[model samples]
Target: MSAHTNPPAPFAGVNATWIYTLGSIVAVYVLLDLLIITDLLSSFADTRSRGMLALVLVSVAAAATRIRYCWFLRSDSGSGLPHIGWTIALFAPAVISWGIAFVIPEGSFFAAVQLWFSGVLFALVASRRLRWWLILLALVLTLIPILVSGMAGDRVELGERHPATVLITIYSLVLPIMLISSLWFWRVVARLDEARSLAAELAVTQERLRFAADLHDIQGHHLQVIALKAELVERTLATKPEYAAEQAGEIRLIAKEAMEETRSLVSGLRDVALRDELENASEVLTLSGAACTLEISSLPAGTDAQRVLAFVVREATTNILRHSNATEASIALAPARGGFELTVKNNGVGEEPGRDGGSGIAGLRARLADVGGTLTADAGRPGAAGHRSFALTAWVPEGGPQ
Candidate 1:
């Protein structure tokens, strides 16, 4: 793992979710406002009276959007998005609300001026992004119109720009849009940061699980075999001392080696080569009195051959031992059309391959899928009629992953 990778902190995760939700709201508001400004809502205005009412309805709907989204932001997930990004998420709803409010023709100037500050304050509270005074500066500067209009005239500046077309000039039109665009930019930054954080967490978790699986496969079966052998030795010792001594001595060596292997496994540096896993399976199957043949033609150079071989050999040998009382077991690895194939077949009545977890075939399928390979179990002939046979086959793509 890269040293730069970091899991999403609790607060960071929470912030990411909020950003996603609020960003969706802002995107919707902008789209709707753009549509409305295209005179789409004008169809609802049959007369001058209705036109005014329709505008009011649109403004109220836009305002209610802010309230609705604030309620959405009240979630209590422990995740914390980056402080900077979350700050942007928190502001997004209000920034969008300002965009919607600013574009519409307002019945009263007070509402138009008030809505911008309201959205900014809410964003500040939710994100704690900027100093209150910094955001308030915009409100204070924009409110200059209200103060000047109040002093010079009577209700003249209610919805009027200082100069008749001041709103069309370089100030209101250009600057407001530019500021709105900046808010959107911050929201995007927050989302990208959040995604990176989640990917890092996923990588860490997968690495941890990979290590655990390695340890389990290495030691679990070794311990099982040692336990079985120790039991057999104890039984023989009671019958004859010399024979029992021989068995005990053999058990001691195997046990000691297994212990050393156990230590090596836990340090997370161990890997079971494909060849070793196949050899281990062969030893296990031979001990169970089944005639076994291994036909392996190719190897993926530089990889642990035993580990790659283990998945097929282990599950196949296991089925031969437990489900089938077969007299013969055959394992083959050869080139296939796409990649390569490994198969194990037995000439005996085969139980369902994955009916139980103990069979390990299901686990085998999952393990192969990790490396973009596949495992399949089938019930059919063992190159002979009237004898039941089960086969486990796996194929891996030539490019290493599907």
Candidate 2:
């Protein structure tokens, strides 16, 4: 299946929901660690060991940083190797916890679990490489400490009685399970991100193709009519000057109409009517899970201001869909202080991670300025419930600049 049509997978992207979920999980772990640390969970000496507490805190910190880095990585263009700093940031926690696990007073189930979790975390980050050999190498590295702890056991006992046996067995199961699970999780996320990007590019490509096809059809049809009319005019010119003149007039009319049609097609591609644009915007917003309300009293079919305002509606709708998780959106157009006002408003305005003010609004502003129009984008007045909204407002005079 194409990536765009693929069903949504769990943890597919580092969205707000994923961030909150991860934070909640970390909080729960922190709470559990605190209880264990204060001897509230259990009175066993090993359970409340200072070393275990240190390991738990470090592990949690490491996991949080690793997840944060992964989230940042997802926003990147997914080209070239990921920054070495992220690799260090992600790997450091796992390695440190490994050392702590090795030095625990004695091998315990909790230590085994911590070691396993660390291994899995490493795998999740490393899976970004999407290389099987590298993952295998990571698995080997994860196993080294477990091996070391096992071999460090006293030699007096051999076979089943060895301290290393239980440690080895626990890790033998833990390492593979965590490694496979993490590998699958990261792979799914990578694929989902790749699919999302490809889908966007494909949409643009298809639009370009459609535009090319339309241009070809329109030009070809007009050229054919012009060629046939020219032949008829040539045939009549010799026998009847009047007939030739009449044909010539027809030719001129046809040529003029064709030129106008071509220009109209080109302009219409860029500037649709405000009413049509509103309908399309509403459909797109609704498809994207936003409830849309359009409040334009009346939109003239072929006015200059309508064309410019239509472009604004198109751009603002695109930004709302691509950049926000808005649940509701509203667009309104009305007469204002000697001019027309167009505004697109939606909730869920916030800075996108890893992006500055996007080029859409900036480019829209420049376009409006070229036509003696003004564009304003800002946080809207807070609602009674103090909900934040982002609004894009534009004003164009009765007629566009002369």
Candidate 3:
């Protein structure tokens, strides 16, 4: 597998359900705030104006939620500040809502609080160096509106003597800190998940290196001995015919032993059970952020085809991890066309379908052909969302390899 240039984000392979759950919590919090703000504004404005303000507030909150979902939860959100256009997009609605709230009695406090909530989300996903700075700036900005409106005799109840003012002040101060703490905890979890995936990949790489070393040692020793014997036989053939014949016989015996030893090594490697491969593939894929499903009818007992199919499953898993950005995948094995068929499918085909047909596919095809089986790969049609699918199917006869 080729190395990726940019490392995946901490949350890149995290479970979608976890992300959505956290998002739902944030949404519910926003909804509650919206409810409180609506209640506070009820006695202050005409029906039409209040409705318009609610609509604007909902839009701003929804936009902030989208930013959290799409960027913050899904990718490397806090790596840096967003572009200038995004910055404008983030703050424009809040500013407009603040302006609208300033005209209405008892509305500015809620608006300031709403704006602070949005700012907290924005700062949560900002670069490390800028996150605290932006958060403090937002806090200061929030306090300004509250302090000015209160001192100006607006009905916000920010006076030193008012209990409501003290409560509001405390809430405003505490809300951002609470938000920052929760999101910080989430970031830490994402980092741990990413590290887990890296460790799995590292383990697989180490195993492959070890296997290669063992194969090299076995082949290197046997091949060197074979070469030396062949040279000795060639030199003796001219004057010592009997000795040459004996040497040639010894060479043949050595060749046979070498072939047998190599086969034994390979058989040991192929001893992996088909069921184990399926389970391992499912687990590894899940860790890498893809949901994997498996369906297997009664598997045949002790057959070469089972071993080959196990290999197919292993290879398919590797391809999905290395070659695609798949979110869902499945492995199914059943009886088909007077034989047993194994199908591996994923919804992660890239723009270029042909890229999916790499040397790995060719190698699988060759392996299947050796066992009188067939291997085929299809880059399926684009779905409604314009994402394509890839399926690899392998079929082997009922009895096993021919």
Candidate 4:
């Protein structure tokens, strides 16, 4: 059994009746064929000419059904056309067998036709990766009626015993096998697709981890230094009163700025600016007696573009002030590939705890990621040691991020 064949969904799921009706009819067609061959319904209909007529009628109906279903699939109106095709395929041999019935007698010629129909059914089931064995077994059972009917056909008179055609036999034996096989195959394919989807999600998670680690280190160091300076000044105030007071005031000011920076990182705001963050970082450093520098590239414009970039800049600046102790930080926003890229760099202490982005930073990343955007940070290349840099990139669709 190969595994892709799908038995198709229930009528409710497919929102269709044609396929189910056709499938029901097919069930009847095969059953009738079998009962007629076994002499159980000799009085119901003639096995020779009448059987041929019946098979022909069934084939025409099946073909018409399949054609209608194919149209349904092509249309945007509804679903289930595909399932109708499956039932039609199962009944196809009946139509062709009917044609053979007229051309040939109720003997070897008719038997060969039944054999051929069995082969067609087998091919269809196997093509969709259903269980081939059940269909193969059906073909074998069909031969029983063909062989028995042929031998008994000569012994009985038309006036008494009814004839059994080979086509009818094949339909009976093979129909059950096809239905069961198609159903089994349907389950296999669905499971495989689900597994593949899950694997892809797992891979994406690993990339997120790397991003989280780098952000924390850069932001933590800056925050720690500011905190330590403030505590020291607070204690010294009691001794060298004038100098202590001055240091205490400076410390109080730095503490206030750091608090503001922390708030920006925590807020769920959508401003993601490469330039603004750098500028803010420069301001904070200057106030703390550190120098600052800024560089910005042209940015693409669209609905809400400026606002989102602002948030990005805000968060980046917060990170720099909280972690890096460097005097200068550079920010840049430029067009890259097919979208815009934002970069923030600062010569901050290599790693610190609070600097590693928290849930707040992760939340900011999610904003872009949700819209198919990405955020990444690098600690700078050689000659750039003691510096941390972040590059945020997002590809806006034809219109823009929603």
Top candidate on lDDT is: 3
The clash tally of candidate 2 reads 0
lDDT of 4 by residue, 84-187 (tens): 44655645654455344333334333433353443444343344344365456545544554455456664234223444544454554565555445444444
lDDT to native, each model: 0.55, 0.59, 0.67, 0.50
TM-score for each model: 0.53, 0.38, 0.54, 0.42
Question: Per-residue lDDT for 348 in model 2?
Answer: 65
Q: Using TM-score as the measure, what is the rank order of every candidate, best first?
A: 3, 1, 4, 2
Per-model clash counts, in order, read 18, 0, 0, 29
Taking every candidate in turn, the Cα RMSD to the unseen true structure, in Å, is 13.3, 22.4, 22.7, 12.6
**Stretches > 4 Å off in candidate 1:** 1-180, 239-268, 291-306, 318-327, 333-340, 347-350, 355-359, 366-373, 381-388, 396-402
Q: What is the C-alpha lDDT profile of model 1 across 63-175, one tens digit per residue?
A: 45544444433432223323554445544443443443333333223224434533442443343445344456656644554455455553453434223233322333343
The residue ranges of model 3 lying beyond 4 angstroms of the native Cα positions read 1-13, 17-21, 44-70, 155-172, 269-402
Residue-by-residue lDDT tens digits, candidate 3, 1-402: 897697646455555535654675476456545554455444335455764566456545645653553354334445665566666666776666565555643555656665666676677667767778888887777666666676678753434223344455565577656665656566677788879889999999977764664354345444544665577678879999898898788678767865775687766752546897788678666755678998999675646788778768867777776677789999999988778899999998675455537766676676677788999888888876777899999998877666
| lDDT, model 1 | 0.55
Q: Give lDDT tens digits, candidate 2, residues 6-119.
A: 656664454444555445434543443343233312323446767766666665666566446544423322245457777677667666776765676243323334444444
- Local error of candidate 4 at residue 185 (angstroms): 8.6
Top model number, TM-score:
3
